[model samples]
Target: MPIVEINFDGLIGPSHNYAGLSFGNLAAMKNAGAVSQPRAAALQGIAKMRSNIALGLTQGMFLPHPRPNRAWLTQLSTDVDSASSELLANAMSASPMWAANAATVSPAPDTADGRCHLTVANLRTMPHRSHEWPNTLAQLRLAFGNEQHFAVHGPVPPAFGDEGAANHMRLTPSHEAPGLEVFVYGVAGGAFPARQHVEAFRAIARVHRLNPERTLFAAQSEEAIAAGAFHNDVVAVANGPVLFAHEQAFADKAALLDTCTRLVPGFEYVEVPAAEVPLTDAISSYLFNGQLVTLPGGEMALIVPSEARETASVWAWLQRHLAGNGAIRRVEVVDVRQSMANGGGPACLRLRVACDPATVDPRFLVDDAKLDRMAEVVASHWPEEIAVADLGRSSLIEAVESARAQMLDLLDLTQLASG
Candidate 1:
């Protein structure tokens, strides 16, 4: 089978808001209580998918998980009407928009069974994101249901926190070749929570049947995590044979790269020094959170948020990087400020699955026409803005529900509404 990388982005949900639910994320906390533009946010996400398609990359999408999750509220033994402010915010969270946290996927070439395996993330570290696994699992099953080519597993036990692909990186010579899977875990992050537990990723490797020799586990630097690089993706990203990261991203950066150089053929790295681009600048601008992708012509490009361009240090380093003869040849800037304000950038908005697109559900795959249709629905139905205090309004709840239903109906994915 010919394998290609498909970036499955989660459509920004209609209930998208900034209640500052994520503690370790500086952007989220900085923008707390701010009004959010759901319509603009969803449209921005669609535009991003369109840009990837224009670049000759395969693009897929995961619908927003049902919001105002009444089921989760009921699980807490309280109705939305009577729930505390915190409980209501948790139930109404749209954190699922960051699809990178949705799951960890090991491509067929890297797994023991020669079939792609996906494990839904428990996201157990945070209250608002903890209830996402069940719905995410349902979507994964539907999209990659071909048992002969794909194996979808439920979340590992909640005792250990797992933030999914955000903390995972796979390095390969080619998309079809077996790869070196790197799982980055955090032990301490000052006052912040370390979301990816070591044991959780170990369990995923076992479940995916990945070879221990080909799998590497690395510890995220406590400084990086304390600087608000909550997930590894915020400080490092790997594509094909190249690993682009901050010099301070890992606790043992030299050792990690040494192992990759030995295990991964033609492994190359571009490490930005903290002196050039301070860790604070990297985290605030989300420079490392950008997607480092191999374009169709075999040249590599970094897809970054516009914020990266606006940051002086980040932009300066990127220009110098482009001027040099580096493996990453180009930089593509995109507008995802809405997601950025909520602590997700271009990379955080996507989950990369390397597989033959034909084996996946066609409904999840997209073209320009599909993007056009989805954008229309978002513009027509999604809320203009959501104020923090408006979360409890009956009118806003109805609007949010109706907007998602219309999107589901348009995509012929109403089945997900009930999941």
Candidate 2:
């Protein structure tokens, strides 16, 4: 009954981060220090609105609790917010088509299991929402048909940042074109040791054909009501190193690195405490191309474009401990500081869509030249097109939804009968 089978593969979706192929060291250093006149001038408007702009920009996707909120902090975060917003806008305006977004999914070799995803947040926000999820998922949906027999992981109930936690959702598609099988989890509560959270995520891994005993890499956040949630399904691996245990409230720097004892082969990262690893020094990013997009919840492959990529580091304590893994993509580029400051590198800006169970998908297995050419070809047809990587999620969804509708109309049932 399913077009694709579930494999114990992992997540297949787009994400945005603060690391990627950088513009170069000189450019990065030039911009690294305090804001320049023009840059500062641009930030003035944002700063006036809020005082603490830097923190907002540097803050990880999710941070832990107990940090005092000061009036100055708001101002600095606002600056970060303003800068991030402008960068996201630039990325979105760069895309030529709505293909940037696709159904968010993970690979599952079991039956038709997969991950289902749809984000429920103001993606327009600077570092937090910004263009990462929206742009990544948008193009993916476009490359792969939207609403397919795949999985979707998105916002749950109570909204993110609500009740000191965010709600996440996973959908299993029985059908595409509004595709869904079962909403693996329509409403999930807290992430730490909560049965509700475990059951919800476990449902997705089961779809992916993953053994309940296997370990899973999960994105963590101290502010997350869902801390330690991933441990329920399988072992959880996190990328960001530095997390504040729910019990610790602050953060245990030593414990952060201790968690890094486990790392997947081919990808190696040992946890290092924040005091030891400077956040601003710079880090390298990786690329993911032609990789199979696996969905754990939905039990099917969601549509992914040709590639996806990312780069990340665990600078904050809260994010590191809670999130088990950063992103795992092939390392293509390195040290993209300018790009990183804008809040994401190559991998951070992509969304994957494909149901291929193999390590590689033939259609997606092209070299970088071909991938660029594909974007070029698509761009030629539409002048408004920017890099598929640039567009935001809302714009991406609008594009893919249109594509599916058009594809349905153009296919002629009569032609099949004649052939």
- In model 1, which runs have C-alpha deviations exceeding 4 angstroms? none
The TM-score that candidate 1 achieves is 0.99
| Model 1, global lDDT | 0.95
lDDT of 2 by residue, 1-419 (tens): 23332211111111112222122222222333322121221122122112111212110011011011112234455421333533433332211111112122443432334433323222221232223333333323332323454333433232222100122211222222122111112133243222223244444344444433232323333322132221111111112121112221112324323333332222223333435322222222111111112233322111111111222342233244336443332111223232323322222322222244232223322333432443333233222322323333455434423332332233221111111
* TM-score of each predicted structure versus truth: 0.99, 0.33
Q: How high is the lDDT of residue 246 in model 2?
A: 27
List RMSD in Å for every model shown.
0.6, 16.4
Residues 1-419 of candidate 1: C-alpha lDDT, one tens digit per residue: 89999999999999999999999999999999999999999999999999999999999999987879999988989977998888888889989989999999999999999999999999999999999999999999999999999999999999999999999999999999889999999999999989999999999999999999999999999999999999999999999999999999999988898999999999999899999999999999999899889999999999999999999999999999889878889999999999999999999999999999999999999999999999999999999999999998889999999999999999999999965
- Top-TM-score structure, candidate number: 1
Task: Supply candidate 1's per-residue lDDT for 38.
Answer: 94
